[model samples]
Target: MSQSKPSFSDKKQITYYSRLTQLGIGEEILITLPELSGLMFTSTRHCRTLLGQMHEYGLIKWEPKVGRNQRSTLTLLYTLAELKAELAQNMITAGDYEKALSLIDNDKALFEKLLVHTSGTQMREGQLHIQLTYDRPFSSLLPHQPQRNSERFLLRQIYSCLTRCNRDGAVSDALAHHWIYDETNLVWKFFLRPGLSFHDGSEINAEVIVSLFKELQTRPPYIKELAHIQSISASGALCIQFELRRPDPGLAGLFADVRYSIQPISQLLSTTKAIGCGVFQIQEHSDEKLKLITNNQYHGYRAFTDSVTIWQVSRSKDYNPGEIEIRTGGLVSNQSSSCSSYLSAGKTNSGLSEQVHNRIEDGCLLGILNHRSHFTDSQLKKIRYLLFSNESLKNKLDQSLDYNIEGVLAYNLLPNWVKLSAITDNDTQLPKKISVALFNHKGLEGCAKAISSILADNGIECDINCYSFDEFYRRAFASTLSEDLLLTSVNFDDNRPTSVYCWLLSDPVLHQSLPQQQRRWLYQELEALSSITTPQNYLTQLEPIATTLVASHLLLPMFHHKQTLHFEGLLQGVKMSPWGWPELRDVWFEQ
Candidate 1:
């Protein structure tokens, strides 16, 4: 895989050779040396070597022209696809799957045939590793750094918090066995479980727990989320205590958030990977894939599954809306101990309840109009109305963004009790041209195209920019400030309203969207809700933030996504978590 070869011996030899065949095969055609080199994706010297290799294989005949910009005559002898297909088939039959699969050369037909049996799941060294086909690469595994729900799920497995939230939104034991609130002193003491160790075999004592919370202060989101903690001190070797400036009704639930996962950062492969005390340990981490091994040193019940490997899979040329479906068709047997699947929402083909788990997530795909742009309030209102005021536009967008698969038209930002149905005031100004930015993702380019097509009919020009995942999220400020609109998805634990408080304080993009006075006023409003003990009272008071944002036309909710997981029938205890992800530790294969 590391060594280079003659361009003719390249796996894409099929594509290059077939292109040459198009130039009146068996008859010399006039073509420049540079043109041939460009077609073959090789240097001029390699072009000559490739021609020689092809001539030896009876694929093409070449004649050289000895002057600059002079034409070179090349005659094709045979078709390349058929020839390479035959060789690759022979390689497949001879057990050289690696070499056979290398002939992708962007050929969809050959790729499907060769990949049919190699994708999905397999057993190696008696470990059960389910290879889930994912659309994006794995993000950092460190606590408070999750960029997606998938990464959040993986991080949840790889780390533990002092407390955990049950499915019902109640606090439960995690690293800490139990906790008691001292009413007199406004303190919380959490009793830790004994015999706990990190993935690296370091003891997880009270001091380690104290260090974890101290570490959280340096990370954003949590830095604001944990602001109520006035002090974190080790009570003893097996206990930890927290002193708060004021009483927090939801402190335990806040601590249970996965963003607050306790982990000791460690170095590996010249990059840092988290060393956590959870049911699973990250054994391999990369952009291509992430593999987790069961943590044998965990305090409580160990993970029943041996391993979970998520493969970062991009959509091939032949892709369907119903499925990203990276697994090849036919001969990829279900007989393996592990499973591999390109998951999508809805009932599976088997019609069995156990075959799939599905639920609507609390997240939303949002189109935020950039307030930093030159657009007036009336213009932003006009754009929002044009995009979402009518039913057909939202429906058309639903299909473009795969929202029809298992999503609902978002009536409001929060999925809970808030229902917004007010008609937008149509009296407005309009922009002649706007620049739109989107995080380059599945169906998003299509989304931009659809929006462009709609705006073109309205005599408005659009400049579209798509940023990679890293570029969009890691740039430290709202990249959309320079554009007219930004399209992205946000997942938050809306089961509790603390997320609303945290997002307002921590989300740079959202924070930058409001005017200076408006932002200051919103911050003061959010600050006033901190002491509210009742969840209903808290949410009721917080309702104005959503109404204010919508009234100002800062952001529009497009759709709410539905998350689903498909697993083999043998996998037991398959269920969806509140945040729309499955806990891998809870799943086990049948013996």
Candidate 2:
């Protein structure tokens, strides 16, 4: 009788062969199925399936012990070429094969070819190695420019904000040791931590603080943040006082924005010479990569690793699983790739480890109706009811790819955190025809199709218009959006509802369209919320305002999406900020 050949999934074959090539001849390795599962981001059952196929193929002898501690062992029985042939047949990438071979031969050249750069500490101490991919090349390290999350991640490491928001969204001291608010005088007194110094060894004082604010007042984003500042003065040696135009309780939150990273006045003119009192100092920066070294002169906790190197790859597939990887949404796939470990944020489950899966509640998706468009108020209200009231439509839309329904479907502008009275359902007449504008991005086309189908079922004609992201932004800012409805997203920098309120009011286009009375009401509500000192009470004050806004039918809240991070087993003490960036100061490699 002829012997039959065993079959395996592409993931199983690649993982098995890769592991085999890493071992020396006659070297035995013991790996518990659970441990292997964690490493591969696979289920224990799937790991067993892979082992079964390996044994059937005569690739390894799987010995199972009857004890909990002694789980199973895999022994190599095939030559390197034989394993290579299997991997090639399974269609593993050339880069992956080279990575595996490099591990076997202990060759640094092949590994270097795959990575952008490897630091001396990483090479010598087997320290943490991280790989990141971005959609666009990094523009600037300057704080004034609008930055993506990747840029902010690097900035947080190399720069220091006056106040920092912890994982729980509470404000903590960074450059400033502590601060006080004088309600009577409408002023804030910030006391700098003594002995604070920049990377160049100059002591930080009230003059530096005042100078930074003066520079900030000249830039955008900060222009709005500093508009209420009546005057800023350096008091004593370490004290800097700011007199506000009004009594604002959320002033600390404003200082905590990542864009407010304090820099020396002397280095402000030189963009290349970016310097701050952060935990890490910039060793080198370019469009392709950023290299950082630990700051021994840091006043607070020091980074556990000596250096960090971030490379901007063009695509996620370029990421090597052998090193730590950071990626945004939509890059990971359903099938596991042996080339690298995976972490997914939001609603994606592609190769995500349960331990590393995180859900951030700060991101809110909105469906804003352009009051300037053709739709009338009644028509808009009816459309909102049709979309939000139908449970079936919500379920179908929730199942769409990359759509995370973890957050409550927003009926109003306020996030689910704020309690508000329920919106009473009323029967209304639907418009015969409706036009919706959606940005042409990944997964949104499917969403547009779903919405069209839903409206069609209700006997209404739906027109879905898709435009590129640039064109969409152009139309939005120009107030020339022809569609009655627009889909958009916004993220709050701080946990306070005041930030959300400010964002709603700051949009020049949106603000211009609001009626005079409504605009006055918005400013009045903002003042009320800003005066509340306690966060809980501030949230309480948001309910009435949110209820009034939702009744206006101007904005519809859809859902909130969370960001995720995946780390290799070698990384320890990893804590991510609320803004979805890893706090690297304490992250260390596990032995």
Candidate 3:
């Protein structure tokens, strides 16, 4: 086997030749010079040189300017049988040779009329094409920097977390081959896989792991997560140990988050561009598109597609067939026929042959009252009653938004898994007028308008105000909200119920504007709840506190927003995280 192996320098050339041979004899392949150049990762001049060499060898004939937009044609001179024999002699393993032959045999018809093009290149037998939406144009490859859903999706391809969380909420190893927790010592030790190399060809080991965590600690969210960590030390090349201030059962889940992806310390300091050990490597990235090629040296399950291209689309209607379109803004009432709609939670439209929708229970939307508003206590009580009890407004919002009101309705802060008794409502008379403020997120505009309309129908005169997210945050921090009520949403990325409540109650900007006695009691209640370790005890202790908070009308739980992913065609082995992002490693195109 070793004696028949091709030389390292010739391997890529052989692979390229093999791909061309799969086209079979007499096949007129229509491919633009730019497309071929991108596929080969070379300049147009270099691609021309490679094509000329192939033409000289009698493997293919290049016909210049034969198709639309001056695209050239390349005719293959070798048959599949001849290519199989050539690959058999060059491939290091019998399995590789057989796989190559099988692909050619399976896609024989496609090869006969293959139209090589950009955008849909991944739809071809060995490619994967995807479309994602970003809020704005950016080039930061760092996993933590990109705040949009599209950028985060692209980052997942380039980065690998220490651990992975499955759809069933199970924690599994990714970079860390195995891990163990020392309860008595409050220590967590992880054993990494051997011989793992980053995309930049740097070895992954314990020292690198420790350094990444140390660097991560300097960031905002990671700093909060790692606050309990006393120290992170490397025992050897393959083992890393973390000492914590206290026992945390959910520590492994924290590592499973993509934000904590491990990267080389050198890359962290040297550049903002990413260098990862995941299944894909960034070939090129720009404001409009992000292109990735498979990382052959990846230690885990390799992606089936040779390359993936993510296009930044302005609207859902821009999606095309054979592409995975991620629509962060909920599906509009008017969906175009260009592509089938798939919810982010993995639900498909009825009768749509090619669609994938994965529903993720990500977070809840809440109605927050500005406690510092000038309204008297009685007036506040009436406002809360009108907002929560008005079913007409909720229904209109639900119909316009196309969301299940009952399914997403949140009566408590805890997730559905933790069942707490519902709060008893004390009805109050409607006030003459009320004002509500909403952040100017495009998706929330319809819902906010619906609320205003509903309030108008009642005796109350409704004043609806919109503010930019930054302006809203600034006013919120300064406790100078102009509206009586604020409409906003919060994602509980951390599955732990305690963490969710801690964030809600402990936010200084949010709760500081409350009356002194109410603020004191809220903090006191949170402090007591924080001490309970067991989930059962915690839930039992939290029931009355949640009830009290709801009754106080400071925060009104509205509904949980279900995250969905819509795709144009069938995708196999697709799964989603609790936070609504797709697990793309195992996903493959199904034709």
Best by lDDT: 1
In model 2, what are the clashing residue pairs, if there are any?
Answer: 321-339, 321-340, 345-564
Say which prediction, candidate 2 or candidate 3, comes out ahead on lDDT.
2
Ranking by lDDT: 1, 2, 3
TM-score of 2: 0.65
Model 3: ten consecutive residues of lowest lDDT? 112-121
lDDT over C-alpha atoms for residue 87 of model 1 = 58
lDDT of each candidate versus the true structure: 0.63, 0.59, 0.58
How should the candidates be ordered by TM-score, best one leading? Answer: 1, 2, 3
lDDT (tens digit, per residue) of candidate 3 on 70-172: 7788897766455443444232122132343354454432321111111122243345544333334445777554233335555667888888754333677
Question: Which wins on TM-score, candidate 1 or candidate 2?
Answer: 1
Clash counts per candidate, in order, are 0, 3, 13
Model 1 weakest lDDT span, ten residues long: 331-340
lDDT by residue (tens digit), candidate 2, 336-455: 221222332212224534346355445455666766565666676676676654465457665654343333555555455543333433565677777878675333454566677788
Q: Residue 152 in candidate 3 has what lDDT?
A: 52
Indicate whether candidate 1 or candidate 3 has the larger lDDT. Answer: 1
Report the C-alpha lDDT of model 1 over 1-591, residue by residue, as the tens digit. Answer: 101222234556566676676566567788998998887778888787877777666666778788999998787765566666655644443334457657644554564454332343343455554444454567677655536555666767888888776534557788888888876787888898888888888788988778767777666656655677899999889988889877766676667766677766432222377777788898988886677888888777877667666655554443422232323222222221011223221112244233666666665777777667867766777777777545655556555633233466665666663655544456565678878787765445555666776788788899998887667766425334467777776666623555555666567667656667777787666656665453334556666777677667786776666665565554566666645545556665543
> What is the model-wide C-alpha lDDT for candidate 1?
0.63
